[model samples]
Target: MELADRVQSLTPSSTLAITSKAKALKDEGHDVIGLGAGEPDFNTPSYILDAAKEAMDHGQTKYTPSGGLVPLKNAIRGKFERDQNLSYTNSEIIVTTGAKHALYTLFQVLLNRGDEVIVPVPYWVSYPEQIKLAEGQPVYVKASEENSFKITPEQLEDSITSYTKAVIINSPSNPTGVLYTKEELQALGEVALKNNIFIVSDEIYEKLIYGQQSHQSIATISDDLKDITIIINGVSKSHAMTGWRIGYAAGNENIIKAMTNLASHATSNPTSIAQYAAIAAYSHDENEIEQMKLAFEERLNKLYNWITSIPNVSCVKPDGAFYLFPNFKNVVNHSSFDSVDEWVKQLLEEEKVAVVPGSGFGSEDNIRLSYATSLDNLEEAAKRIKRFVEKHSK
Candidate 1:
């Protein structure tokens, strides 16, 4: 039998593929430094682990409500209020399996056949795919590197049509690590409001910012903007709970209800013990988050400098997240590679340093190198990348 048409349209994730390949190489005893991972390298904090243990000891391991544990929802509600002074009732919240799933569920519920979601270029690799899986059309809006990889309000307005249902905004965006300033978001939010398009704000990397960069939630711009915005976030990145698989979406009551209903048939619920741990994650002090952020900032600074030092490599200094997306078009041209993907593969094979090509993120000329690993690994990886560039330079 033929597979479903949607299955045929789907593209397997390139980020995970590269990371998996690097792991296989390492397992074969090859010295491999994989920079394709999107999670924090830190372990979940002791408080959160203790909470999970307590929940299990208290027999809280059973399934939760299809939405999530009531306490976890309350904690998530409190988090938004604390972080952005943004209020979201439990009815407007749905804890999900992960931030990725939150986006998936949001699209599933929000889109219908031929509905369009405007995705900025250099997006998280999954945005377009998730939209497509929801039977929605993904209209790509290129956010050029010259513009600091941010889509202008004019670009957003130009992309919208009657079929446009929503536009995704990933502040401290993955791959590029660029943060949208408050002013920039205000402009975009105004356009979104004017165009009557939902704003899917992915703030998964909110807590992992670098020097002088603050996270701005488009929802917090105004009550109107807040009403039309869906915030996707989770403990995976912020609390280093990637293994725990806890995330959430907060927005309009109707949309949240729809997402909760879909999640019931889909995931049943997020893990109950993980929900308990997330309560601790949200209620606790910010100490653990600070330390992780500092580590990433250090690595980002060092790696950014190291990678940019290579001949013909140029990078935009990012304000948030743990990635350095360097434009290697010049390097690729100088090194005689036909494409960025070819250069990435050659670097991995010849130098055993695996970095994700930017092709998957909608920028064919750039590549994303994650610094979410140890200083030693990152430093060595940078050295390998530099050497690879030098060796391949014509």
Candidate 2:
């Protein structure tokens, strides 16, 4: 059998592969601990779940609008105003299956065959792959560990060319959990505006922040840049509704309409019940979210302290997001294994702990360790990881 050339050239997700391997080991009677997943371990809030149940009971299961239901869109608009301090109309938003799908649709709608997108190194694993799948070129700009795994405006400007179509920014980023400050975003937004490049801001982890730093969308930093920026968010991470698969994006009216048209042909609309649940998520009690945030904060502090105790492994102590991207190069240099991929494989085999290699996120000699698990599981995983480093480091 023959497959399309596009599909043939793609690589499966490394994170999911690690997760599957861990589950397989567990099934075979091994005590494998998984720290490779990107979702919050918390269950969906009861109010959101109740809303879904209510939607089902009311027989609102039929097909909705091709974009999304008006109520959900309105809810999303309200969220932008209340949270991000950015306002948008219903027509300016497009709801998709997930933030991943919102990004996929944005790439497909905006990129042409030879267009180039500037992506920072150690980015979310899906960014470059989705760009490739859309027939656009992904140009990677490297950022050093000293910079907290974030790219500067100078770095971003150095990567631009006539063919540059967009720059993708993820704050409280996956794999790194690094959040860009308002000053940094304003500087980058200026560069994007001057160059006429679109900015794709992935703010999925906005609500998961800790410490004195706050999450700021690039669009909120500048008015001139607003029309060119596409802001992607979802209730998955913030509300712990990953399985529901509901996400939305706000952008220029034309771009949102174009993305909606693309979404119409692709998935029609996101799940109806999920959309209803998402509306509740956007409008739910703030105290419930605060409780969830506090729990994550407790777990994050525990994991950070445990990880810092291990020699030769240093992390940024991110302000947002539930991940710790530690630089493992001191222990597992390139010469230690054939590649980061092999290093991760050997670590998984030897320690029975799952982590995603940095290669998947456009870097080497690092690994993304998610803290989105139970405190007990995290403590145990940290012990195993520390032992693995001690045994492997030269």
Candidate 3:
């Protein structure tokens, strides 16, 4: 049987592909150090797990409201007010299975056939595919490395078109780990307001920042922007609850209601137990979250220095998130490999260090290595990468 055109046109996620390849190699008895993982390696904090247990013991196994439970919504609302200085009513929030699901649902509800969503370069891999799945086009604005992998207001203005419906802003971005400053977001918000388009702010990595860098929600810039912005976030990265699949979106009540309706037919509610766990995640003391951030910061500092110390590799120090995206153009140019993909393949095969090639994230000159694992694993991976670059350097 023939697949739908949408399925045929979709590209498999290269991040998952590389990760699976690494797992296969490990299963074959090779000591593979897989660094492509997007989730934190840490376990869910005990308090959140305890909450799940309590919910289960109370027979909270049935389906909830299609959007989310009232308690979970209240917790999410409180989180936004406390962290972002933004307030939302229960009608304005819809909790989906994950942030990714929230995004997919948003596209399905917000876009019409041939609508365009502006996506910046070095974006999270799923953004473009999710837009396309909604019969929308993804217009990419190249965020050059010199700009710290961020697009400017002028670039945003240039990318908008008659068909443009939304612009995605993934701060503390995946793959690149770059955060947008508050002022930067304000300027971009102006462009969105001027163009009468929506701003889809993916703040899933909001709590993962290091040092003085801060995560700012674009929706908090002003009432106008908030009216047009959809805030996508969850407990996946923040609370190390990737498997729990509790993510939510806050925005116009109409859109949230539509998304909830769509989800009602698709997956019903998010897992009942997971919703209860997320309530605890949002309500509990944040000490565990801070500890996780400190651990990642330490790993990032060591691994960033180690990678930059190598001969032919260069990377911008990430402000947040757990990944290091380092440019390997020099290494690729000097080696027998014709592309970053080939270089990544050979490195995984020979050195047993798995990394997602930058081509998958809309840039072909770099590769992403996550520091979410232990420092020992990062150190070992760095050693292997350093050797690989040295052997291939011109």
Candidate 4:
């Protein structure tokens, strides 16, 4: 059997691959401490679960509008108003199976053959693949560790071309946990506006911020930017509802309509019960989310200090999200290993610790460690990593 050229050319996710390998080792009775999982460690709040139960008991198991249920859309609208001070009508919102699906649909609707989408380095694993699936070229702009793994306005301006259709900005970014400041976003928004290009703002980690850092939507900078920005978000990360499949996109009504129409033939709608549950998630108190965020903050602080204390390992202290991207370039050079990949493999095989290599995120000098686990697990993983580095160092 033959696969499509596009499918054949796609790169499998390194995060998922490392996670699977860790799980396999665990199944084989190895005590593997895996730091590759991206979702929150908390369970979905009971109120949200109760809402789903009520929906099922009240017969909401049937299909909803392809775009989403009106109530859910209204809840999302309310969230935007309360959180970001941005308002969107129901027509501008379309809920999909997940934030990932919302993004894939956006690329499908927005891209034409050979169109370019400017993706920053150390991007979420799925962005480039989704662009390729939509027949769009991914133009990568490298964001150095010195810049907190964020692209400058100059870099953004330089990467634009006639074929550039959109630029993705992921704040509280997945692998790096780097948050772009409001001023930074304003500058980038200006670049996109001047170029007449679209901004795909993936704010799925918006609610997962820590310290004094805040998540700012590029769309909120101005009316002009809002008109051209598509905000991709969901309750998956915020409410520990990763399994709920209730992500949505908010932006231009025409683009939302096109994405909805595409979704109508594809997923039809996000799961009915999950949509109802998400309504409760958005409409209710956020105490649960606050608790989870605090827990993550605590774990992150400890893990950050621990990792940086290790010899020759340095990382930008993450401002938000539950991951720490630590550069091991010095360690790699001092160790017997030739590359970060081999170093990561040996750590997993010998110390029984699993982490995603930075090469997957377009950085070869670092590795991503997700603190979205128990503090105990994180501590143990750190110990194992420290020991491994000590043993291999020349």
Candidate 5:
């Protein structure tokens, strides 16, 4: 049987591959502590769940507009205005299956053959692969640990060429859990504005911030820049609604319309009940959000302290998000193990801990460990990692 040439260009997400292996061990009655998952461990908040239930009871289980229902769009608009200080009318917003889908749709709408997307190294596993699947090239602008895993405006400018179509900015970024400061975002925005390139800001973790700092969306900096920015956000991380799969994008009306048209022929609409749940999520109590933020902060502190205890492991304490992208280079090439993948595989096989290797995220010598598990499990996972590193560090 023949297969598409594109399939040869794609790789399975290493994060999910490790996750599946860990799940298989757990099913076989092993006590595997999985710290690889990217989603929050918390259940979807009760009010949001109740909203979904009520929607189902009220017979709201039909198809919706491909972009989203009018109320959800309006709620999303209000959210952007109140939170990010970016205003978007109904035509400028579209809700999709998840932020991933929102991004894939945007790539489909925007990319042509030979088009390039500048993605920083240590990127979310899907970004470059998705770009390839879209028939666009992903040009990675590598950032070092010295810069706290952030790509500079100069790097952004340098990566741009005549065929460069967009740059992806994942604030409170996925693997590194690094949040770009307002100054940095503005600087990058300046480059995008100058080059007349689109900026796809993945602000999915905006509501999950840990410290005193708040999220500053790039589009909010200026109306002039807003037209070229696509803000991808969702309820998955913040509200612990990964299964609900409700995500949205706000940007220029033309792009939104294109994404919606693409979605209509693809997904038709995001789940109707989930959309209703998202309405509650966007309009829910501030207190619930505050409580979740506090809990995440506590977990972040626990993981940060524990990571430092590992002999050669060091991590940046993220201002937001539930991940700690620790550098284990000292143990990587120096280890008895051949590669980071081998080290992680041995740990999963021996210590019963599951973590995604940094190589999977474009950083070969580092690894990402999520603290979105239970407090007890986080403690155990950290303990296992520390032991593994110490034994392998020679």
Candidate 6:
């Protein structure tokens, strides 16, 4: 049987691949310390779980409006207004299975064949694949590790072509965990506005900042930018609700309506029970979010310190999110490995410590390590990694 060309060209997600491999090793009785898992280690807060149970008990397990329940939309609307000072009507929002699904569907509705989306390198693994799946071209613009793995407005401006349709902005990004500052977003928003390109802001990690850092939504920069920008976010990371799979896009009403219509023919609607649970997530007390953020910040600090202690390994301290992207090229070369990908495989096989190869994220010299696990597990993983470095350097 032949697979479609779109499906054939797609690569397996490195984070999930590494995580599956680690799970396999563990199932085989190895003491694998997997740092590739992207979701928070914490259980979804009890309140949200209770909400789900209550929803099920109340017979709320049927299909919802294709766009989302109005109350859920109101909850989401209140969230944006409270958190980012951005407002959108029910007609301007579409909730999907997850933030990942929202991106996939948005591209399906936004792209024509041969249209281009400017995707910064070291991106979340799915961006390029999703664009290609929609018959759109993904124009990669490298975001240098030196600039904390962020791209500049000049770079974005230089990448635009007549076929360019939209540019992705993933702040507190998946692989890098770096936040774009307000001034930075303003400049980039200006470029997008000037070029008449839409901005797709993926802010799933918006609530997970550390230290003095803050998350900024590019849509909140101005009304014009908001008009052209689509905000992608959900309860997955912020509320430890990854499995619930409730995410949404807020933007132009036309785009939202099109996505809703497309979804009606596709999913019918996001899970009804999950929609009610997500309403509780946005409606009720959010103290659990702060608690998870504090735990992640602590783990990030310790893991970042431990990983950076290795000889020839360096990392930029992330402003938010739970991942540390450390450059190990010098370490790889010094350890006699030909490539970072091979080094990552050997490290997993030999030391049983799993981290994602950055090649999958478009960087051949780095690896992504998630700190969304217990401090005990992280400490052991770091020790094993340090031991691997020393052993290989010998």
Candidates' C-alpha lDDT: 0.92, 0.88, 0.94, 0.94, 0.89, 0.93
State the displacement of the C-alpha of residue 359, model 2, in Å, after optimal TM-score superposition.
0.9
The C-alpha local distance difference test score for the whole of candidate 1 amounts to: 0.92
lDDT of 1 at 97: 94
What clash count does candidate 6 reach?
A: 0
For candidate 4, give the lDDT of residue 22: 97
The digit string of per-residue lDDT tens for model 4 on 229-341 reads 99999999999999999999999999999999999999888999999999999989988899999999999999999999999999999888889999999999998899999
Q: List the residue pairs that clash in candidate 4.
A: none
TM values, all candidates: 0.99, 0.97, 0.99, 0.99, 0.98, 0.99
Task: Give lDDT tens digits, candidate 2, residues 131-182.
Answer: 9999999999987789988999999999999999999899988888888988
lDDT per residue as tens, model 6, 1-394: 9988889998888888888999999999999998898899899988889989999999998888998999999999999999998888999999999989899999999999999999998899999999999999999999998888889999999999999999999998989989999999999999999999999999999999999988899998889999999999999999988999999999999999999999999899999999999999998877888888889999988998999998999999999989999999999889788999999999999999999999999999999999988999999999999999999994
lDDT value for candidate 3?
A: 0.94
Off by over 4 Å in 2: 333-338
Model 5, C-alpha of 335: deviation from truth (Å): 2.6
After TM-score superposition, the amount by which residue 293's alpha carbon in candidate 5 deviates from its true location, in angstroms, is: 1.6
Judge candidate 5 against the unseen true structure and give its global Cα lDDT, from 0 to 1. Answer: 0.89
Deviation (Å) of 394 in candidate 5: 1.9
lDDT by residue for model 5 over 244-361, one digit each (tens)? 9999998988999999999999999999999999999999776877787788889999889988887767777787888888887777766888887788899999899998999988
Worst 10 residues of 6 by lDDT: 283-292
How well is each residue in 194-301 modelled by candidate 3, as lDDT tens digits? 999999999999999999888889998899999999999999999999999999999999999999999999999999999999999988899999999999999999
Worst 10 residues of 1 by lDDT: 207-216
Ranking by lDDT: 3, 4, 6, 1, 5, 2
- TM-score of structure candidate 3: 0.99
